[model samples]
Target: MDSSLYALVEDLRGVDAAQVLSHGVSSITVGAAYHRARDVTPHGRTRVTFRQDGIHFPPGDLFDGLRLLPPVQRDADQEPLKALRDQTRELGVPLHGWAVFLHSTTLGLAFPDVTQENCFGDRAAPADLCPSNPDVRAYAVALGRAVARQGMDSVVSESLHFGMFGHGYHHERSFVDLGSAAEFALGLCFCPHCQARLPGAETARTAASRLAASVLDGGPPATELPTVLEDYARSRTPIVTSLAADVADAVAAEGSSLTFLDLTGAVKGYADGRPTGGPAADSAWQIGVDPSAVSDVVPSYAILCYAHDEDRVAEDVAAYRTALGPDTTLRAVLRPGVPDTTSSDHLAAKVTAARKAGANTVDYYSYGLVPLPVLSRIPH
Candidate 1:
């Protein structure tokens, strides 16, 4: 620790800085998603899934595609149990205590009601959790506390909302629910809870479309376009982050820092060419997907995920740093094996390029797939 940082840590030995700025730039982040989950069979050691769940959850979500930490290790005495703690203190890496927030896909198999509706108001479409439900919140809070007590320096509150694989892509022209959307529609949550918490979700969704329409054409942003979109962002993003704040608070109250991880994979595609199809609603959709929103929420730490690429990934990191600004903390998550076509040189270059791109911290996704020895060569 730097002299100043040491003094600060000493001064606030037990401070819940999840509510304040986090420490350090020599930061690193690694998730259970980066390793293979343990599996067993009656006859021999068979491959087993350590992921959150399988197909048919979250309306096209696949946690299994990502690595899952072995459930056994989460218990005391497991190698990972000590390793997780040692890694953080030794390396100054904050182990983002991540859980598929309200993502009950796997848990839902036994606890059916755990599913939260999609932004479109359909609960059956995918496995999520009802944020309005006290039960879901309680369970997540319990999980958060569990991780915080495990010597984790920071907590990364992931999946803390009502969304699925195709969040805005499924928006209807005039449709408000998940499955139903009108041509110019920007799909939004008319969910009972959302309506209860923020009555303006519907109106804001409408305004988003109006603004989108103006922006699509040659209409000047000086008109109602910019104002409407800005209102939608102000109304929407903070509410979601506030909800995230609540989750972080649960963990922070136990003396851990809470970081917010947004789904960057989706954002990358959208920036690339994912259609801006309907209404002036990109910002509204961004409310759920952007790193900039992470800063708005007051998370001491922010995680930015990006798909593998030559140019796009670095550019994504650069833009992320600019958007998150200096006050907020940020982490860059690079998905290393999704394509598996990258060369050794490409991987090394990407890692170096990410830090140069201004990522305050760095982490990798999808474990066993990264070729352990090759990954071991990475200088964390």
Candidate 2:
């Protein structure tokens, strides 16, 4: 199995790179573009870092067919990605660029029209850029091509589809009893761009609005999604597939492959350990993701195995293996510490489970977020 570790630019300092490399990791997935992060090191000092509106590295003169809404920024002095890329190359380890595609609070807040609009007309989700929006689509395409141009062996795409209401804004305090289904209904984008694609979008919007309103008024828990809304949600599959195709093409042009990271399993695992089976596995549809459909577009898929139980993580990996078929490259991402992790032994067991479950590769979720001692958890 291919062994890799996810890392931030700052993690390339001093002997940190050498230390991680000593763990027998074959590749390093560096975060080229990302969202806000709050991490604590072994020293007990916690730091929260936020990016304004751009990439860690300097951009090329032209984006070819891709475009950015607020323009891409860079920190030349740090040259984070480039420096890390060189460091990994010297160690004979391949470097893959990890890019956060659509979740941009800065650009979304700046361009609310392109942001996702809930059924209740709440465009408060500043971190979620609507996939149906033409500009956002172009931006994602551009991001993939740009990251590839940085000489990465592969590009791991994150948040490439629809984001929910639970993902955005700050200091959210909800006392209302908005159940999962109602909250999901309210998170549906009713923007003009989305409406133009679905035939009965307006009707679905009305139904969703009523359901959300009922829940906000302290109604019973929403057990299921309205049929109209469900159909509307499924319609997002094609949009996401097309976007993936564009990104695949962009990555190909740069001689780098695209690895689509499906967040559906992670979503389900985090929100009550419900298995993503039956109509629920299709909940990925709600997020504009259809993993099986995208397999034809991208050559590889990285499924999130964030569940607490090692057995549960194995099951999640097996499901993706079955869905993506035998030929598609399947990689599993594991969080060694924090959240659910207890010890390095726990991480080792999970890694063994992933490999036995038919994963072609296993990758650690992050390098900077976890402390140095925890970083040693990667099984050599």
Candidate 3:
């Protein structure tokens, strides 16, 4: 869509969309809901009008717009890209591609070697992969490249981390290779390499073997964690680091430009005698940081929500700006339609707050969760 048309749309201008797309839009006004995390539905449904066509897409037709389908295996997944690219281009909106990195949903079938085990000696995870497996790393890199080749505007690695959930570290009975408690706190990989390496190489098998020997299995050996963590980071970072950098490289090769965003939770919040924490909007950045896990490779975090409290939106953004440094950008998600909240209009207010808090760019959920009318609350 052309900026003139987008302006027409923003101004409620009565103009032809067809004419505008053939041209280009000068600016954009994004319409979004508080959340796009819709629950399981038989088909994808976007609850509002797409700026591209202004057609209200039913759930069935929304999947492609959301990029939920798989890319063409042989075409480097670029087969169904024209429609997606055209629609986005017509709308003058940038895309944020979502990819579930280390965690794959293809268990019991594709790449089962990395699946985690349980006390029953059976695969415990549904389809999640172990982060430390080298093959798994390669798979992630390949998948990223595939997506990048498809011309995604920006890539967000959704779940690039250890297993989703499990119980006590059962070295002899579970699928995960456990490392020291510190490693666990800081994103432990625990594959054979990680475990064999205790601060670093203390895999479940090694830990059990050593523990069984009754040598007190004391402290993690010196030079163990730093060395192991560095290696772990190197191996793990490529999965994402490569994907992000690859997208940039791929776009550059084609003489195009794209942005790569990384998200994760670096700090923990204490409460209820338990350590609970929120995850990143991108999910993959939660881990031990090295230049690889996060580097110039990732430009910024696309969207961030504190989950516990949206009122803290400004504060969280402020903290990230300070800790990560101002040049590192952030996108703050706002939910103004909370059932009984009266503090402020959600999207616009949050956008304003983010700017005041030093955020230069922004992205938010669309239509269903947040309507276009919400823009009134945000002062342009």
Candidate 4:
């Protein structure tokens, strides 16, 4: 199960929240570090809550020498994680921490140099920190270690890969109709760090610039541009994989495992839960996530099986299972209601499908966001 600090501290309190969240799941993962969002918490103290982009705990010595430090959340003083940790301990339920890395508007705005710059030399996504940057890598490792230090069984790492252009900002406006290929081209980073790290970065940037320009001028989309961009995108695998390895090492040192959260399914299926094209795993490369590479480094993964159909969910999980191999632990994340699910039976079928497809664990999407009745749909 996934939850937030506000849900634990303000909504259900400590023990009550832990007991409520522990109902059908073996472990509970809370958002210890997250990006900015305004979510409607159906059962929360407030009908809606605005979450700031920052860590929920005090950094202390975690980021002592790091240039790209995490911003502390406004409610950090409440020590929600600490309280939940104690409560879960009493309930004998393992507590895990969910940390969003490399996707913070606060840090990106504060240190523009660390953000991703596109082919046009403009900041592509102000909220996305280029993973190729040394400081960003260090910060990610430190953040993982910090979360692990809270006595978590594992740290579920989200947004560890590159951000897409369509979902980078809130209320993002684009009057011009940039096609998927154009958006992909514009989202590529040509910053100094990416240029220094990726091979043939200059050539890729030039191709990307021309492709984006052509699309903007209503010209025919170049067939070769996406292929070039994809080749360039493959070059980012090492950077993200190595970063995951670093974070895994850091978390392991603190006696906790790292679960790499791949949001490809969510990107494809979040709205209506009917994702088209190839399996989510096949498209993961576009976001710098090479499942095989990442799985080799991090033994555990959390795949967002956000689709509604059981067959679709199974297919997505099966692809990830093949990519990750049988040795790695695969956790399938599902939504209990709305966009993805319509009833308890619908949710249960997806869960069973995921497990049969090689998911060792089936975790629900959220605690506060979904209604209590919807949460009850989780297979025990």
Task: Give the residue spans of candidate 4 off by over 4 A.
Answer: 1-17, 220-225
lDDT of 2 by residue, 223-259 (tens): 6888888888888889999998899899989999999
TM-score of 2: 0.92
lDDT of 3 by residue, 130-149 (tens): 64555555544444444444
Cα displacement (Å) at residue 209, model 2: 0.3
**What does candidate 3 score on TM?**
0.54
lDDT rank, highest first?
Answer: 4, 2, 1, 3
Steric clashes per prediction = 22, 0, 26, 0
TM-score of model 4 vs. true structure: 0.95
Q: Which candidate is the best by lDDT?
A: 4
lDDT of 2: 0.78
Each prediction's TM-score versus the true structure: 0.61, 0.92, 0.54, 0.95
**lDDT (10s digit) by residue, model 4, range 1-380:** 33212232334443454556645776777889988888888877777977789888888798998998899977788888888788779977788889999999989988888899989999858898989999999999999999999898899999898877777667688777677888888888889999999877999999889988987788865445467788998889899999999999999999999999998998899889999989999999888999999999997999888888999999999999999999999988888888999998998898889889989888877877877888887766
In model 2, residue pairs whose N, Cα or C atoms come closer than 3 Å (at least 3 residues apart or on different chains), thus clashing, are: none
* Candidate 3 RMSD to the real structure: 10.5
Error of 4 at 352 (Å): 0.7
RMSD after Cα superposition, model 1: 11.5
